[model samples]
Target: MKIAVLVYGSPTASSAAATAYRYARAAIGLGHQITRVFFYGEGVHGASALAAPPQDEVNWGQRWQQLAQEHEIEMIVCIAAALRRGVLNQQEAQRHGKSAANLAAGFELSGLGQLADAALNSDRLITFGG
Candidate 1:
């Protein structure tokens, strides 16, 4: 199956983000293909390289990065939502005159058109957020 996951919750605020991550892992373990993992709203935090959780806590951003690296999943953060939340890529940071880019290595900032494409092309579009 081709699956696309959309997350809109903050990595620290709720389990929605973590749950989505687990689901993606399980899906891949079961031999399902994940087309994309789209992060919108507060979920864009999952793509921020600057995210440093407590040592005892899981760094969801790093977890997602590892997952993307291992599975080659396309992890995308909504550009508008990410920018609003201070998550910027190199190009966006340059364009907005920011000091540095914070988007993690395995993630990219994109538009809703990617989400639209995911929905249209994937067999399932699972959303994990409010």
Candidate 2:
């Protein structure tokens, strides 16, 4: 099966994001294909390169990055939501005159059109978080 995941919760503030990650991993393990992982609202924090969790805590951003790398998943952050939360790519940072970009590697900032496309293309569109 082809799946697309939409995340809507913060990595630290809720378990929704972690649950999404586990679901993705399990789906892949079961020989399913994940077409896209769309991060919206507070879930955009999962793509923040500047995130610094405590030494004992798992860095969800890094975990997502690794997952994307290993599985070649299309990880996308909602441009509007991400921008509102101060998560910027290099181009966006430059355009907005921000000092730096905090978007983690393997994740791209895109529009809702991507989400629409994912929904249309995938066999299942699963939403996590809020």
Candidate 3:
């Protein structure tokens, strides 16, 4: 199966983001193809490079990055939502004249078109968030 995941929860708010991460791992473990992981709304926080959780706290960003690295999953963050929430990649930061970018590795900034493509091409489009 080809599965695409949409996340809308912040990593620290609730279990939605963590659940989505587990779902992606489980799907991959079951030999399913991950078409994409689109982070929207608060979920875009999971891709913020500036995030620094406590040592005991789970750094969801690193987890997602490792997952993508090992599984080759396409991780994307909605550009609008990310910018509104203060997450920016190098290119976007330069374009917006920001001092620095805070987008984490293993993720890319894009519009809803990527999500639309995932929905149109994947066998399943799973969403995790309110």
Could you estimate the TM-score for every candidate? Answer: 0.96, 0.97, 0.96
Tens-place lDDT per residue, model 3, 1-130, is 9999999988888787899999999999999998799999999999998889889988889999999998889999999999998899889899999999999988999999999999999999999985
Q: How are the candidates ranked when ordered by TM-score, highest leading?
A: 2, 1, 3
Model 2 off-target regions past 4 Å?
A: none
Candidate 1 residue pairs in clash (backbone atoms < 3 Å)? none
Q: What is the C-alpha lDDT of each candidate?
A: 0.92, 0.94, 0.92
Q: Which model is ahead, 2 or 3, in terms of lDDT? A: 2
Q: Model 2 lDDT vs. the true structure?
A: 0.94
The weakest ten consecutive residues by lDDT in model 2 span: 9-18
Question: Highest TM-score, which number?
Answer: 2
How far does residue 22 in candidate 2 sit from its true spot (Å)? 0.3
In terms of lDDT, the poorest run of 10 residues in model 1 is: 45-54
